[model samples]
Target: MDKMQRMEQLVEQLNQYNYHYYTLDQPLVSDKEYDLLYDELTALEAETGITLPDSPTGRVGGELLQGFKPHRHLAPLWSLDKAQNEEQLINWNNRVLRLIADYNSKNPDTPLPDPTYVVELKFDGLTLNLTYTDGKLVQASTRGNGVIGEGILAQVKTIKSVPLTIPFTAGTIEVQGEGIMNLSVLAKYNETAAEPLKNARNAAAGALRNLNPRTTAERKLNAYFYNVGYSDGIRFSSHQEMVAFLKENRFKVNPHVTYHDSFQEVIDVLHTIVDKRSSLDYLIDGAVIKITDMRTREVLGYTDKFPRWAVAFKFEAEETTTVLESVTWNVGRTGKITPLARVEPVELAGVTVQNCTLNNVGDIERKNLKFALGTRVFIRRSNDVIPEILGKVTEEQDGGEIVYPVNCPACGFPLEQRGAHLFCNNRLDCKPQIVSRITHFASRDAMDIETFSEKTAEQLHDELNVREPAELYTLTFEQLIKLERFGEKKANNLLKAIEESKGRDLASFLYALGIPNTGKSTTKVLADHFRDLDKIMNATVEELTELPDIGGIVAESIVSFFADPFMQAGIHKMLSLGVEAKPPQQAAPVTDSFFSGKTVVLTGTLHQLGRDEATARLEALGAKVTGSVSKKTDLVIAGEKAGSKLAKAQELGIPVIEDEDELIKLLNGQNE
Candidate 1:
């Protein structure tokens, strides 16, 4: 046979060998034997000065690209709603039941069947959408914004398990999978690299996104296909069928793909996966739960953000260790000093974390971090909050001591010990404290000043000699116009906002005052109960504590705040400058409403009602709206994409009202 014909034969045989070895993890030929054939194919391709598109030799690294071109996906990639715990998973199942039942009710003649589910690992890696026409791989792209993605076909071709050609030569189709660096591969690569990679996920993602395909090839990435996003001449009745098609096409399918007729069985599999996660060779932050029935998925349909038929169960907070380099103290508007620990930058949960909250000096002492400077410490990040230093790696203090400050770092004022916290009493003179106070007073919850920001407050403080909330009312348009970035329109707008804030009701004014230990809820309660600011100011600690949700600490805070001469003078000055602090007019109690006397919680996105509007309506009807699910909750109004709280409510067996129409009817007194 000629070289070209021989190359063709060798390519087909080698591709089959590759499929068995990489995709199937069952090698049909020894490494030495495969290399001989590969060498011959390479030599023949060089001799002919040509390479076939489907040749096994195409897997080699190629020349660098100038830039990535945009490729719009044939079908939009959808994001799944997430569940953090089993309670949330249960809630998702409940939502599925309701949607299926509602659809079945509408179409009695062609009712949908009870839903089965498929669970697969949510791999921590870059998402790849590969397009094929006539069973030949034609395009590959990232999941950028879901609709359009950066084309990386050259880079994707480097993945050994990815099939360049499939047996089915039908119309065009798009297959979705995750491009991941196996943990073992990452470790092996790091052993000899000049610059070691911090995590497998970033290594895979960076390699795939690199301009040079040769860099991607060196990563030795693997891919696991689990979805057929678009197909012109094919369709699947279930997720199991789609995965089977992927495997049949020689696409690498994860072994953990599980199907169950029962949701309980699905949960069991998830628990097992979590337990076996550390033993796996790749990184997975969570597991995805998808309904198996295509008809059921169609019935459930999509929210603007995610499909109602699927949800991701995320694992707990990720933890990592880094050196505690130093700690910096910051003073807040409340005069409390907080310790901010600066640590050696470490990759955790897909981001670099260099700073962690130490909370206070007492937290440092309790965690034995008082002498943790320059020592390794455990840090944890959860729910997207700032990372926190959990504790030192060991009890032994092998590093220098974390010296406590005797004076405020922001203003150098003498500090006072207040239980577990240290306080700086120079509230009026301290630059940080005064700037923060002014900023808080003009915040959205407080005065609702338009275009007002912390930087604006700082400028006003430094350039215009403005300090305290009352001083904001005294500013002139002429004064503001002279400041940097302040034009005539901006100055007038600021003045207008300041003037409009004078008519704000008592609750907002109270919250703007920045009373220690009191939040917006407490201020609202104080306003609603007392009606007048003077009454609240004169209220004894006993009287303040009598109200619901007001504990001793809150009552003491309110009493101590109003008792201060400086605070009293500030309130008086604001009133003198036309600040109304208007009391709300009394209305009859909502004693005979459907939601009256009930404790309710709201979760998820409501298409018909904004969360704030829903909360206002619930409060108007005498419902005590809360932020969490608990035994005390009488009802839970779950909207689209409801997650953990919805699950917690279901777990606690609380009554749930998911129908927007029903909620609107009840809210309108039609149901009552």
Candidate 2:
């Protein structure tokens, strides 16, 4: 067969397989066989240079777009009003009933009866609006504001569960759904990803907004149609009927939707979902309760931003009250001192939490957090990670106001306040600070020294008198064998890991050094700009500040750190110890770029790029990026969200660019 004919055959076969696997819950072919077919299709498409829009190979990805185009939605996507507790939910139900009663009174001939509710899980993901015409998918967009959205048709086409076409041949139909990455999918991605995704919601949102459709396809995103936003040639009497129609038309609808006659039943469904939340393969922050009767919804109408017929019942945060025992100060890698609260052991989200962070002295003062020994305090486990102290629950005070330490907890050096944080000036002498720095150097995200732990660092510091990172290379395996829990095999492995870390890239080495205000992204920027550690060491503050996202304070911090005699000696010692920091592979610079040599600041949340990604993109286009707005800033890109930097740009009269498309146009010298 010809390449075109083979491609058509492959597309047909693959689409059938996907439909069976994702929609039918059955598979006719093994995973290995499917992969082989997919590979064959990919090769054939490449050979022929012909790709069909509905082809299963589209799930692999497509070319990157310069920017997303604005799409005016056919119908308004209203945000639902939220209820945090049972009382609030009941109040909302009462309002719905009252509105329906008023409507019935007006139309005496056709009196409305009691209203029922349809409760569905509120999936924690990005809202997507899909438009279908003549049973064929035409467009997909995100919920940007309410009336207009960013077009994401290419990314949406890559999702296996989202039907490209349906059996129904109805005229223009718009369906609303959520674009989500399953928790299992996110976990698998995070296993090999350099930067782990925080949660399923963020993973899904990030994938959909990426400029590359291939990234979204690689994420294996899913969508569940819930509501019919607009229909030209179709009609439904109730929400339940609409959901049924969606399912019958081969669209993926949520399975947890239920029709409830009473408010108590809706509450029961919420409880059930909450109980099953840990076991589900997706994340749900709340349950949506909407009037089931279509007539009731029309009568109730909508408020400014939310529909009066629907309310979102948010699940209560996992929190409990515990007794505050005492507070302790801990020193970190950068010699920054943090206050920690030693709370009475309490079980939160199935884990025993004994300690929680109090942030700093400013946080304590802002929260009016006073802790007497044995004082009851509220603690919450947010996002199932760290347990944070909410506030003091009991009024009874047994101890005096908690005091901020004037000296470092480990080295007894005088503490210096830098903004909201307290820092220990003794960078070389503090034991805790040294241990933390060493531990961070060996962390997986930094140098990736396998088997290195905080306890190991502490033991090495206390026993072997290891004062600096270079000293670790001089330690013998025999010496490690002398430490507690260190056997012959373990000591050998640790030594091997230390030896391996010496060959890490310059970015990792820079981050391992624990330079002040230098995170992974900043280290990468520095490495990409300077290429070598020696150049970075000799760079002036002006040169450093000229890089993207590097502000005056961060540049000053970097210069101050590199100029320190102790730091210079330590770096030389490491280099002498066979630590080979490789320079980043170079790329040709972009010439005649409009953004070249311009200082730009991005404020609020950009739909297409995260803060780090935006900084990198702007830097790639030859723009100098900074975090804050200033009179010196040549341009400010303000996004959907509101932030202080946006306000400052207006106050300073700095020219502000709205949305990514406008920025792209400006960069292409197409701005009018």
Candidate 3:
């Protein structure tokens, strides 16, 4: 075949392998083989006239910029008034309620629902704005001191969660989301470092500010959008309800959001979260307390800064404003595009600052920011990694209105919207999508086919027409002999890696699918509960939701997945290639016990084992766990300062037991 034909064939195959590995979780090739193929393709592309926009050659290593310039915003990115303690919170709550009461009392014609509040776990991370013009992602910016910040268009692209384009057919849309670290990123990064990370939030801020896009990818940072920035005539009644709308538009949102009828309900929700905060996966520094009515926010209006209708009660200092320099974009494992912001290096508490997250195209409109144009912006860097643009308008200046992209930079596809997201539909031909997917599929967690690397996949797919992972097992030594750096033994090793991936756990397979909302924990829950993929696919949303830890979102994703033709076809194809998932071994059914329906609270200290172990044992014994001491507690197992728990148990007059000795004996008794 001619050189042009060969190059086209190679690019297509590499991207397919990337998609399966990166986005979907299944990898079919060995790194060595993939690399050899990619190297050959690169050489050919250089020698021949054929060029592909999605070529693996483009995603090579690059250096960080010398420095960043800031863009001043049109509006000042003002800081919020914070409530630190219960008294402050109560005082604020009283004032808000009194305002509504007075407003309603004066205007007897209109009755209100007591002006309820929506309480959400204030994510301890950076804030961001993604501007979408004509429903396409264009530019991202930091909330410069609430006025101006740096521009990080290229750096923003590194974050996969931030969409490069909006999926809507409308002329414009903006989104707002919190850019934060993944659940376990810090722990993993710190495990090998000289000084392990102190917390996840810090790691997130540092990661987003990183100049290296590849490093940003490795951190696995994530973002969830919650508000609409600027839309032409977009309609929504309440901010709480808008969350649902954003999700419909394909934006990520906080899972712990709730509405309340009274301040007590709001307090109850807030306290409940604080009590069980440790159990939450993502880091949270405070609670975002807001009025449920949009009109109320407008009526309350803003002072020089902050919305009078809303207050952020910070729990622990996780998010603090810094300065921004720029924003960049990246196409993730899926065809979806993401945005990140780059900022001028500044110190928040201790760590140096630079960039944070703008989140996606929707953010730009919501934040209503101009380019940094060389000004300081307020960036909240959590724990020193995931930095997000929040406030920065120190002074007002005019920059051109930020616009979103209309076409995919990778495949040039018009973006398609799904709920709160914008996804590129040219998956079949998109180069970046394919490469990213392949990288993920071949990752150690998926297939454990360690021989495959992004470089290798690029080579094999683009140079050799190896479209799918399964094709890796089909390569011949004769093909290797024709490549640029031919060596038969290396080719053999690549073949060996493919052979080893045939038998992997069902959990890994599910994770590899790159199904939306399906992370490692959810994968384990679904796999362990169902025991097989067929059952998971056929199960109704209700059935899936019934499983503990398997939430409604995950169930919906599984259902929606089975509803797709291409995924089903891919599944059958994979199954035909001898790809199989092994179910986890389970223990024999244990005897019924008295703790079956009881809830237990273990506070302060436990002498027998750590908290996780104790919780595990309690769960194994069929007992539910509550973080706080309560009247409904069947028994309170207190150890030492168990302070509040001990006092609360006494107040309720519930029987309080101490130590594992008595608890074990009580369990043996089986009832009384």
Question: Evaluated with TM-score, which candidate comes out highest?
Answer: 1
Candidate 1 vs candidate 2, lDDT winner: 1
Candidate 3 global lDDT = 0.66
Report the error of model 3 at residue 363, Å: 39
| TM-score against native, each model | 0.54, 0.50, 0.44
Which lDDT tens digits does candidate 1 get at residues 117-160? Answer: 88999999999999999999999999999999999999999999
- Clashes per candidate, residues 3 or more apart or on different chains: 0, 2, 140
Worst 10 residues of 1 by lDDT: 644-653
Question: In angstroms, what RMSD does candidate 1 have relative to the true structure?
Answer: 22.5
* Better structure of 1 and 2 per TM-score: 1
- Estimate the Cα RMSD of every predicted model relative to the unseen true structure: 22.5, 21.0, 23.8
Q: Which regions in candidate 1 have their CA more than 4 angstroms from the true location?
A: 1-317, 588-593, 601-610, 626-632, 636-672
Candidate 2 is scored at a TM of 0.50
Worst 10 residues of 2 by lDDT: 364-373
Ranking by lDDT: 1, 2, 3
Tens-digit lDDT string for candidate 2 (1-672) = 888888888887888888777765556798999999999998887887888767887676779989999999999999989998889999998898888788888999987769888999898899999999998889999999989999999999888888887777859999999999976687577556654454577679999999999889988898888988999988899988998899887777766688989989988888866754544467677889998888778878888889999999887545678887888998888888888899889877668889987777766654446545567777766444467675666444555578889988888898999876899989777898889888988898688899999998999998988888878888898899999888999999999999999998898899898888877768877987888899999999999888877889889989999999989998999899989888876556666677788888876567866665777677777787766666578888876553556545653456787667777676557756
- Once superposed on the true structure, which residue ranges of model 2 sit more than 4 Å away at CA? 1-6, 318-672
TM-score of 3: 0.44
